[model samples]
Target: MSEVPQARRTCRRCVLPESPPDITMDSEGLCSVCLEAQSSKPQPEEELLESDFTRLLGKHRGKQKHDCLVMCSGGKDSTASLYYMRKRYHLNPLAFTFDHGFETEGALRNVHKAVEKLDVDFLFYRSTFMRDMFAKIVTSGSGAILCHLCSMWYMQVALDIAARYDIPLVIAGWTKGQSAHQGTPSNGAGQAGNREYASMSEATRRFLATLKQDPKYRDFPQSMEEVLKRARRRHKAIVLSPHWFLDTHPDEYVELIRRELDWEYPDLSYPAKSTNCSLNFLAMHLSLKHYGYTHYHVEQSKLIRANQQTREEALKDLEFNCPREFLASLAGRLGIELPE
Candidate 1:
């Protein structure tokens, strides 16, 4: 028998680089994080978990006050939040989704299922300039550091909807996993509404003033009138993460929703969504190779710490090296070629 070369240790799914923190190797050539994740652990009772979530829902729920604008993406967490608001808290919320130009069919299916169950009004806003704008943002390299731009677009659409309808609270399915980097309860909506309102207000002014330095973003600043209006809204973007709150396993959570909601799984080769937002995946790939980390690294790391996912499971899900094909496609779409 001849000795064979040991294959480079990489994730089974998406391509995460070999150099990541707390990464351990197993005898089978798998990361310890993945192995532990594959194994299961005891969790809280689903009923009890549901009860606790209901209590949290009530704390934020207000019927007499204006309705809440729930930013839903048709994902498991957001979908579950819909049920909590309706069945548990009993708040009249209007569901909102931003057509980021790239949504999978699975995501779309869940969106419909969620709204149907709640029997609430739904809005899907589409930005005509998203495709071109996103392409430019991603390629400009500025997007890599300023991912908040993409998030801003999502929230802006939701906020505008809330403004038009006079919805005071803008509820979103954000949890500790989403904003773990910023240590606080207000992490859900970024620095939109903290006691530091004075500082944030001043910062926003300076930030917009500086926007003129960039020709691409010069005319993109929100007007002073718009800023004042947003401030008056006192928008309460509540964080709702039903999966984390429920204390259910990933597979079990999905199965429970699937069975309870009578939701039919969409048949799609591309893992559900197929929207105009292919650039998202492409950006992930580039960020992975260039920075040795994908968006999921920081994003999913929070979930791992929250006990939502084992570190190993998160590592696997977080893997996604920059694929050449995706890069080329994105470049062509943006009317650019890979730099020599």
Candidate 2:
């Protein structure tokens, strides 16, 4: 019988393993990420008080047919955001969901149920506009981060939609991990600038730069920074997430959405219980193949640093739980076969 390979050791405080260049383990078995986080001085940050969120909502509410555009992914965080916009803040929100042909049925169902229950206008855009780009990433072996590229495309779409509808504020369900690194709390939503994300963002920017050389993708934004800059010049809209200000935990709101909006967790996900698109499994697999970890590891590590989630919980969620067959099926969709 073949000997089983030993599992790679991870940091004592976070889920990041000994991935070199970007991440490394020290003599104490703690990762460089953990050490840096430990030694860093806490900078003064403007606290995003709940009152501030309420005030922002008040400023935009009742100004137009739809006060805000809520990007609902049918996940717990986004569903809760939709619920709060309608029930808590009493704002007429236009719930928008974009499906790139890889969205899971569970997510779509969750969105349908939430909008029906909230009695809000819903916009579901399903297209294959991204399929060719996604296929290129796999076929050409360009180590481009799928989620980053997808976000660029979708963010541009969201900004255009907001402009078309005359919506002033666009809302997302991004947790603290996603936007906590913005220099100022006011620039929270859709911004990633934390130390942990530095290396990954650099990789994404480099990959996107190469992607822009293609005639088809020539118009694609060179980086997320470019995306935000262009959006600002064209149509100024403040993007915000309620999770940044609200003290509610995922468990707290997951249960609430389950009971109130009839939301059910997806049957399977790479990161255990996440409601990510089906293509995420392929993205995670490829990320782990090239880099030692996926962006989920970065996100979870941030949560661990914030004490929002224990290291053990993050490790559990970050475990490779998806079956090999599922990965093969997803890869087949892109006309690629996984090597044994």
Candidate 3:
């Protein structure tokens, strides 16, 4: 009889295993998650905990027409932001959502539902151009590189949409977990203070280059000249992250919105195909299978350190709930090639 290969052990924190996922161990036999918990990015010794929360509403506080262009995904974060802005801050925002072709029926319905309920002027940008671009990127079988393409495609589209609308403030629900090192809050504060053009500088260009260094996006030149040219065409657009404020207790804020907006808790809110977007699971799976951590692990870890979620909750989310059957079907829908 042939000797069967023994299954390797996985990280105690996440779903990553020791086999092909390549999780490294320290002298203590601890994984990276243990290290991350011990040494997270330092937070301010004192976070200005908001009481009224209206005092913290910089993105929505203005009488200017078309005050903000919100990239809402109809998830808890974006939906909470919208409710806060419209009901609490009373800002006039032009809501925008990118239809990435893989948005589940729930997400689509909720997008339209939220927009209608808010009664705001909403724009849905469905790009066959980007659909083909992403399809080609994924089908090319460039492992772990397609993530950059996905991010860049959305950002470029958002910029184009914001520019066309002449919207000054581009609001998003990006939590501080995703923005701490990315310089988003820094850029947002600068824009709020009206110091300089909301354009990418040499340093910013270099940072963006790191983000797009995946093989799929590697050949593309990261020219500040071209980025600047594009920025020049737009009115001053400052991307403000509402999620930054909710970094400590995002679910608390979401619950508040749930009550205020009378929002129904869908069956697939966080870990399933119900509330959260479905396409995210596929990306999460790829990130986990290749990098040994889902995007949610890195993202949620930051939030956990920031006190948004408990370590237990973060660990649960990092367990990688990729519905294998559903993912194969999604590949077909998005024209991504499937292995026989």
* Maximum-lDDT candidate: 2
Q: What is the Cα-based lDDT of residue 78 in candidate 2? A: 92
Look at candidate 2 and tell me the lDDT of residue 109.
Answer: 95
What is candidate 2's lDDT per residue for 258-328, written digit by digit as tens? 99999999987668778999999888777776666788888788778777779888877876756778878
Taking all chains together, the TM-score of candidate 3 against the true structure is 0.71
Please list the C-alpha lDDT of all candidates, in the order they appear. Answer: 0.52, 0.79, 0.54
Pairs in clash, predicted candidate 2? none
Candidate 1 lDDT by residue in tens digits, 1-340? 1111234455443233343333445666655444554674633334436677666556556653545777777765566666666665678878887765566566777788778866888887765444555455455543232233446556556666676776656666654334322212122245442221222233334444555676766655344334334545665444345545555554564676666665544442211221223455565544443445444554454355345557666654444443566567666766676432
Candidates ranked by lDDT: 2, 3, 1
TM-score of 1: 0.62
Model 3: lDDT of residue 126:
73
Clash count for candidate 3 is: 2
**How displaced is residue 254 in candidate 3, in Å?**
2.7
Candidate numbers, best TM-score first, in rank order: 2, 3, 1
Off by over 4 Å in 3: 1-23, 32-64, 145-147, 180-229, 246-248, 265-276, 304-308
